[model samples]
Target chain A: MTTRRSVLMGTALAAVSGLALSAGLAPATAAEKELNIGFVGVTSGPAAAWGTSNVRSMQVRADWLNELGGVKIGDDTYKINIVTFDDQKDPKRAIAGMEKMAQEGIHYVVGPNVDDGAAAVRPVAESKGIIYFPYAFPKELYTKPASNAVLGMIANYQSAPAIYKYLKENKGVKKVAFIAANESDPLSQRDGGVAAAKALGLEVVAQNDTYPNDTRDFTPVLTPIIRLKPDLLVLSGVSPGNAPLLIRAARELGYTGLISTETAHDAAVLKEGAGELADGFISVGGASTPAIRSKTMDEFIARYTKKFGEYNDESNTKVYALDYIIETLKANPKAINDVAEFKKTVDTFGAPNPYVKEGTLKYVGTTSFGQKRQLSVPMVVTQYKDGAFETLFVGEVD
Target chain B: MEQVIANGLYLGAQYALIALGLTLIFALMNVLNFAHGQMYVLGGFVTYTIYGQLGLPFVLALACSALTLAIVGALVEKFLFRPVIKRSAREESTMLLAAAIAFLMDAIILILFGEKQRGVPKIINGVFVSDSLVMPYDRILVGVIAIAMIASFMAYMQYSRTGRAMRALAQDRVAAQLMGVNVDRYSMIGFALGALLAGVVGGLLVTITGVNSGIGGPISIKAFLMVMIGGAGVVGGAIAGGFILGMMESVGLNVLREFGDVTYLVIFVLLMVFLSLRPNGLMGKPWG
Candidate 1:
């Protein structure tokens, strides 16, 4: 009887030891699984600002996630790793970067910030069944049917109409003179502006296009436009570097009419470039001033500025993209490994509470794009007034 | 019509100022300094640092920029270009070296000042409005300064001993050396003068437009084109070429709004036609 009892006790002890050993190795294996995301954009060259800001925002988001002990997917916590490539703002380089990313087994890609970069990488992403979030301004990028790409930026059509409407109604602007950089995206924005002006019963007196990248003088372009004497001068789709110079040129040439733009969100840079001339200049889609910002947005701006040394206007959108992905993973952990499941999840995912108040992502299917993959957020019209960006209007585009 | 002409003239003056230094350097060294545009950009930054950031007077800053860049140009010639002058296979290597120097200068400027464009405040504010024409005071100032500098340079080239040596060198290098014109010393002086003009143009441009590191490459291209189109080794030809290009761009942009962005292309085509018709450019001497 004593021998049988001793054998039973030894069997129980061995079973308990095996269970403890398995438990100890479970977390190590889980920790080894990482979710790789790829960032391809212009990290050098003229458009370095866009790429650097995007990367910084993504890094901050990753840091926040890692601090929370990584994102949980299917009871397994996975650290997020961002692999980046600099395309130097060239389309061919962008395509090569995309291919390199695919070879690295990264299925989630963030951006090729400009229109050229986006167009180049779209086919690659679609063919490979990768999830691409592009920060682009063209409708053509999303026109194809049912692709795995989603545009995370406001298209020119949406913002132009709203901006023109505001100017016509509030500022009594009737005749508009339009100037844009001669590029694909800028031309699209110019078309949108023309349409918007026509719809609002406004006359486009002068329409001029300058060199996309190398124009140093706006005087020649503005001289003719100023002669027409329009009520509003629209500098559409110009880069941050050129927009302020355009404004300064106009002001120096004694243009007293209202100046507006679709870009130039960085008020500090604009102010520095244009100085007192930046006063009374209006631009679409920027970070709302501290007075109008929500709690979440304010927190985000503080964190971003602390980390990156400047307040990026697109931080809200970038953070939203990452957060949306995280939330989707939480809903279905298997989606991380399954491309179809991930794509479907993103296509049908509801808007998470965005960082900005009333800044919900609305996926609208348009006749132009024929797809509802374009993410439209609330538009904030900001004016440079008294040495700061003041929120003049906040509403949705009809 | 008045605005177009005024615009053309002022724009021409700027191009002339930018092309002057490049023309001078080519005439003296027979080496196309591809880094000339970077020198222009450096001048602008120096003026901005002195006048904009340091809160010094604008005129003093402009002078300082020109002086500093003259020194820098001399140093570059001595250390960088002087050693390469004697080699038989120097042309390709010198071009590469100029490109490398440009990239290095761009990188240094990028590191020192961030990529954001910074403007120097207008030296004089307000516009002179007329019945049919309006001119900004700062622009008029730029035009006047450009004219004064060009005239001074022309006078110096005609009257001064070093200037006469440079002209003689351009006419016949071997003869000038035989006549006791120290080729090396004159070359350094020529580069310094060219850099001084570039520095002044840069300072003026920062006040007129703005300055960023990226502008170096484009401006360099324009200056190079100006020298080629005007005449390879003639100062007067560079001035004429600058005005012609400037007027063409200004008038072309105003009249051909639809084709405004392609003004550069139009200029290029026109240049091709001109070169085909008169292979020596508008004022260039027939190549040997």
Candidate 2:
């Protein structure tokens, strides 16, 4: 035992034994440190596409993380689990879903895609001390400093100004007509657009507040606006189903003026709905066109399309949210149960940071939502051309 | 102004087609078929299945939808309505029955076709572009087809044996029964014709506006409004009401723009006025 050779042999045996012990305990450690994330949104109604895309993307992200030996936090690895509730786009159901998730011990949550659901679920989430990532557009949700919710998508304030600026600088748009569906979010979006257009010195020649969701013939709505002969026609905050039909109706009515929207509808859907008429239309989000997407975005889109049969703009938001959560967890592994620490970490890091390799997210906190919780990514104005959305401009708003 | 008129007239025609079905059912059965709009949506989906998914000719798809709905309508009358009619307390029971049918149809549609809006290729392309106005041929075609179908229906109701029997039943069911008219047979035929009209309109609307399952409720409301404004049991009144409502929407939106969403409020006001001043509606006869 005193010899140098004996000492080396004993040390080697101990190292091997330690390695075996760690290997034996790894499964138990992983089983003990499970993270549950909840998603509450419309998954079974007319707006099902939004929730379907959201859940599928999150699932894909979770699967990828689990495959890579789970999320690493200091010396521990935790398995990521995603639990979902379908709100069917109803506010009462959204609150019920949030309560159910809280009962299930989920502290992290995402979704309530539209305004009503988001508003209804906010207080419930805050009361439970849960971190909520909402895809809604209402600024009031984030205006309160003590709220546990952060907007995971672009706010109407940012989108409206960005869109108006693009139209003014690039298209030389002057007079504008605004139209939207007769829902709370759409109305809010229209008001934002009206204010933005006015602030930018564009005259709002015509505006319509109410178009029903099931409206098949937009001619009654579009004809009057076309008659106004404005330099720009704005269809803001309409559902994916209504947006394209509006475009087709406008084109059929023979208005060649510029058309734009801030709605994050899939360009492929717009193309399918409006066909060749979709060409020359401007919109936010870059899901439909190959020109604006990064290589990583392309791959994600390919995977998403293979799984979901289609790609939507909301998919990008879901992926970014998951990436941000994962990155934040990695930065402060001990922040898992500490809500304040997690919020501080997210607030300090901001966005547009490197997400999954080759992907970057930029979130800006605007005064519009009171606190800096809204995700403010650079606005990408895309024009549909030759059966694809061509990137026209990428710029930021004041 | 010309464009506004054209738009209103076309819209009116569509409303009339949908309302005519509701009026027929009310006239014949003394019960409102709340599921009428679901029938319209189902008709569109059936046409979409035939024309869009199966690669059939559009007209043939329309014909198939109309025929299918006619059979469905007859079955509904024979099985669902006939039993309730025998009970003879249609006010509450039939209302419940219609609502149940509506829910059943909506659930089935949601399960089958999904909530996505389905588009049908325009039967004809191009529009009549002028200095003052633009009109799509699809709109014009819908108007023409509706007018032709309504005219044909009026002729049938006035001349055919079944048509006379239906009118007699509408006037006095007991009297018609005494006159040896087949009440049960005419009721089934009335239901079939009503559903047939909805199917045809639904098929046409697919080409003009596209179709989704969500179209049922709003359409049902509008159809009901048209029936009430035009007079509950009067076909002519239903047509007039549909056109008036269409014109009001077009002109109101044109003049008021954003304020035009209150067009429905205007309709409601007019409805109240009509109820107070002319309770029987524009063309409805007194019950006595």
Candidate 3:
């Protein structure tokens, strides 16, 4: 009777040890179950295109992932869920979006389209340890505040310098004039323009600031611009409400010079707005020609066109790329979880992607400032001609 | 310096022309035409349809557009304003009704055409260079056209039978009815002529600048202010007031460097001070 009882106890102890080992190995072999993402941006307004496109892109990505059986984690598969709010390009609304997302337990978010919105939401996201991928062009948002939570995708405040260099090297541009609105982005960019002029041995003939945000007429400003007659007119903020007005007035006043504006050669819409006036103008954009070569990009564009009946922009591209990144992370669940792990993983993420183009998509700045995150990402300096944009400069990833 | 003056004058002329129409409607109709700017915008849209879509000559397109809008004005006066006048509705009620209609028109345009500005072809081209002072002849053309239109309009009002009849109607509807003048007919004609002027200004604006969907309300407000500051119910005052406002705007924007903002500020101050000193306006023919 004693021998039979000892044999039964040994069998029970072996069974318990086997179950413990299985549980320990389950995390590595099983799949990730779920992902929650947040989006904050100008979902509406004159620039609603930026925000709406992002939402559509993210939704498409979520659908694609779910169709592929969601992200893989320990033994179970979870679907990606996204929550979005319209910041309307307002800083106050942006902060509210960040807080709401944080409260809802969303650790990942996509955008706050403009600089002001990003700045307002950055601190809140950092304190809450949320990972915010902002798409604004301000430099301070990334480099300052000492937070690992913020990632910027564009060239930041350095686009102006880049543009100036292009002009000097390629176009033999020496004398330049600056015309910008007395607003935050334009004013800051104007400073960069001045710096570029001083650094690159270009003579600054004139620097004029227009009324902050008015479109009644720009003849008051245009007269001085026409009078100075510099070789290049760097229209620092041509996407604003007054851009068309300024351009039209400039043409009317018979001043034909090379105009380099974000609006000058960036989008097809400017071609429609400025008509023949926009022809022969130069501008910088984030996307490179090679980005369109990726099969994934082709698929994305095809899918987006099918779904939304329109092509996407760089902002949409960033959203798609980030969605791709998030899915990648989910595929490797051990890569990031809490703040510290995410910071390290994100830092090592690669450069401005050579394979993404829906519109305005870029990733160089958002990831860490490693060799991979360098600004060597491709950029296009385009000119408007024949009612279309012609590439003047196609930069390569260094 | 010469370029600045020429540019300012050019800009000011366009503003005055737009302002004149608003002032006319207000003085004669005693209702703020909120859609006055929309009428201007509509005028541009019509011209776009004629010149851009239909491929008509620029001048012919502009003329047809103006004429179409004048007819539209007559129809509006007959259906909308005529009823209000016949009912002897409260002044505020009539004004509110006009404002509502303006809102409706703006909404309709926005829904139909989207909020992007349409490029209009430049009407006149050529640079005017004198002593190294260069300015676009297109601007001079706008100013010249504005002056000619105002001069002809003033002359017609002073000499023509229909113009006198309209003036009689404006002076007192009941009194004009007591006279041999057909009050309703004159009112319709007044509204039509007012719309015609606005339509022309709209076309001119598109030629110099460009046309967008959302231009009507602000232009209407500027026109109202001009009439009030120039002198209520005075045709001569409307023209003069427009030029003065234009000059102030031009000087404010170019000379002060804070040109655009300063223009509005100076006008507001001028209006306030003038209102305090002479509420009737600078050249108002005071009845009381």
Best by TM-score: 1
lDDT minimum window of 10 residues, candidate 3 chain A: A368-377
Candidate 2's displacement at residue B72, Å, is: 3.6
Per prediction, the TM-score for chain B is: 0.96, 0.96, 0.92
Tens-place lDDT per residue, model 2, A213-287, is 656678877877787889999887877778779989899998899888886666656654677887888777633
Better of 2 and 3 by TM-score: 2
Pull out the clashing pairs in model 2.
Answer: A351-A362, A352-A361, A352-A362, A364-A376, B230-B237
Worst 10 residues of 3 chain B by lDDT: B256-265
lDDT of 1 by residue, B240-273 (tens): 9899888988888877776547777778998899
Q: What C-alpha lDDT, on a 0 to 100 scale, does residue A344 get in candidate 3?
A: 57
Query: Chain A TM-score, candidate 1?
Result: 0.86
Q: What is the DockQ of candidate 2?
A: 0.27
Q: Per-residue CA lDDT of candidate 3, range B20-68, in tens?
A: 6666666567766777777887787778767765778989988986997
**TM-score per candidate, in order?**
0.88, 0.85, 0.73
What is the i-RMS of every prediction?
2.1, 2.4, 4.1
